[model samples]
Target: MDKIIIIDFGGQYTHLIGRKVREKGVYSEIVPYDMKIEEIDSNVKGIILSGGPYHVSEDSPKIDPRILDLGIPILGICYGHQLIAYMSGGKVGPSKKKEYGITYVNIINNNDILKGLSKKEKVWMSHSDSVFSLPDDYEVLAYSENCPIAAFKHKYKPIYGVQWHPEVYHTENGDVIFENFISICNCNRDWKIENLLDKMIEEVRNEVKNGKAIIALSGGIDSSTAAMIAAKAIGNRLVAVFVDHGFMREGEVESIKNTFKELNLIVIEAKDRFLEKIKGVSDPELKRKLIGEEFIRVFEEIAEKVGAEYLIQGTIYPDRIESGLRHSDKIKSHHNVAGIPSKIKFKKIIEPLRDLYKDEVRKIALKLGLPKEIVYRQPFPGPGLAVRIIGEVTKEKLEIIRKADKIVREEIEKSKIREKLWQYFAVLTDTKTTGVKGDERAYGYVVAIRCVESREAMTARFANIPYKLLERISTRITNEIPQVVRVVYDITHKPPATIEWE
Candidate 1:
């Protein structure tokens, strides 16, 4: 398969670049910035240099010189553009005015990478350094108001660089840039979801090798899809274990049980157990750690009963990246990633979707004929509602949030924007506000509604929900849920605030 190699320079959206490539039906992989040139597969048809948080004027990691001579199409973004220019006998220096948000870039010359884009288009910019001079054989392809060299390319070779991030949603016609680059690479768009399903089944069968395996099914797309694939590989030998961690959405337990009725499933009603373990845990990371450790303990007991030698989790690339597994920085500790105890030496772990992103996983789920509800379900954190609650885990708080969240979901669905929004849910904060109910003074918990829109969860913008819908959601939550006296919409984006409150 013709694939693209993305060299990671610790950029937040490095994985997002790979996701966008895969969206074009071409496979792509992210490698460390310092990875040896020989380590890259010979079949890689193109290379993408991801933007990082480092400045090119300072001591930044150098790229392997052999990559330019490999005769493959290469594209650089933001910091990547500066690095490429600095490495190829060009000048790079700190920008007097750092471009951090949306900027307009005007095309000086239409290159293959900028093929269907307009003369001037909006692009996302996040950089402190700029390419002061072009390489000997390179010319400026585009320019912006603040930055002179917005884009550049080799005079003869198939090399390109852009001063903005085309992988993010804020950039207009971002997909056009990716499609143009893939066309330049002449890659075969043969990578399909059906092919992935067959490959995963075969790989799972070989890895299990007649050994029993248990899936930590959380009713999410990742775990559900993993369970379905594992079932196809081992049939009755695979057992799907759903542990009710007390922090799940309302009716989640029943919904999961009914969804996997055909599969060999065991429902462990350990809600009280989980709630007790996290009784006084107010710290978000500490809550995740406790839940993760407790989940393993429950799974271990069930694995022993089933005589399973392997543990399957629906851990995808985002989870691994957020958990600081790969070369990326730590955003948060996912239960499936950082939650797993080091003492879990009993069963070998299997994560089939580890390399896939959320959209990719949903494609596999749809290809496998999984239910629409499960396949198109919103992305839920593995730590469940525990992370949604800002303070200590308590029965009273959980009840309040669960009721409020249900109202938020129902109203969003009624607005016919549930599928359009990436994630829309309610959060219970520790704050208390005074209000009047039935002509009486009442102090109740404050509930926050966070809704964001994004193709991938890497970067997100607050969803522009209709004011009527927002008013409806707020009204329903405050009126129906007595404990929630106040409801506020979270307008913050992903940079300052994550999707989840915790």
Candidate 2:
């Protein structure tokens, strides 16, 4: 396959870069930073350097200097940009003013890589150290207000560097930059995101041949897609288990049951069982761990009776990445990844869509002929409403959040803007406030509305919802949900705040 090789330096969004490339109809593979040159076979068309949490120095995670001599097209982002400048006899150090969030870059030279971008374009930047000066053979292509060398390219070779991230959705015309890079690589745009369906089903069939496999279906896009793939692969050997963990939104359980009627679904009303383990669990990590373990226990009992030897989950790459990326990209503990026990009773664990993102998974779901409700459902956390509440778990708090969430969803859907926003939901915060209700003083909980626009969950921008819509949501939330006295909308993005409150 003609592909681009993304060198992973433990950056949070290294997987995202690969996703962007694959979305552009070109195959992409990720390798560790220390991957040997021999592994860079003839099929490799280009190379990308990913950003990470480190300064450019000799002591940092070093890349092999030999790859530069290979003459393959190379594009470095943030740290990768600085590394290229430093390696090619340029200067790199802390910038006078660090760049973060949406930034504007002025194109000094319209080179081959910056082919489609305007003279001044908005780009996504999050970095401290920058390429202070380029090498003798390199020329600066663009510059921002703070960083002198925002974009650069070698004079003779097909090498380029950009301090901003084109992989992120916040960057204006980001995909155009990748499209230009693909043209430079001269790759055949033959890959389709939906076509991966056959390969996934075949892999599942090969992995779990002649054995019954039980899947933990959460009714979300990821699990539903995985379930469909599993069913086609193993035929009647697949069993879908839905565990009600006492933390779901209003009518979510009933809706899920109705959505998956074709499959042999087993509904386990373990609300009391899960709530017991979650009670008094004020800590977020502990809540996730408890719920995760109890889920495994429930599945094990069901698997034992069904004679199922393999366990399947809808665990995607973001779930694993947020749960600490298996090594050093620590963010938070996702129940599906970090909360899994060290030992399991199943013969093997299968995740057919493990390498995919939410949007990528949606493509596969559509290809499998899944319903639109299941395919386009807003991304939900595995830990459910437990993560939505900041403090300890209780039946009262769950009811409060559930009602508020429904109101938020209802208002958004009624405005005919649900499809525009990536996720629009409510969070019941731990704080309380005093307000006047019915001409009397009343103390009630605070509910926050979070709506963001994002392609991948790695980076996000607050959705520019109409003010009238926000007012309607606020009014309904406070009036219908009597416990909520104050309703505030959250405008923070993913870098500072995750979608979930916990």
Alpha-carbon RMSD of each model: 2.0, 1.6
Score every model by TM-score.
0.94, 0.96
* Candidate 2 whole-model C-alpha lDDT, 0 to 1: 0.88
- Candidate 2, residues 1-502: lDDT per residue as tens digits? 7889999877778889999899888898888888888889998999999888778887888679999888999999888888888989899998899888899999998869999788999988999888888778999999999999999999999989999989888888888888988899998877788878899999999999999999999999988998999999998999999998878889989898998877869999998999998888899988998888888889999999999999889998888877877334678888877788888898888989888989899888888898898888889998899989988989999999999889888888988777788898888889999998999998999999999988888878788889999999888888888888999989899886787777
Report lDDT per candidate: 0.87, 0.88
* Number of the top-ranking candidate, with lDDT as the measure: 2
Model 1: pairs clashing at backbone N, Cα or C within 3 Å: none
* 425 Cα displacement, candidate 2 (Å): 0.9
Stretches > 4 Å off in candidate 1: 57-59
Candidate 2 residue pairs that clash: none
Q: In each prediction, how many residue pairs overlap at the backbone (N, C-alpha, C within less than 3 A)?
A: 0, 0
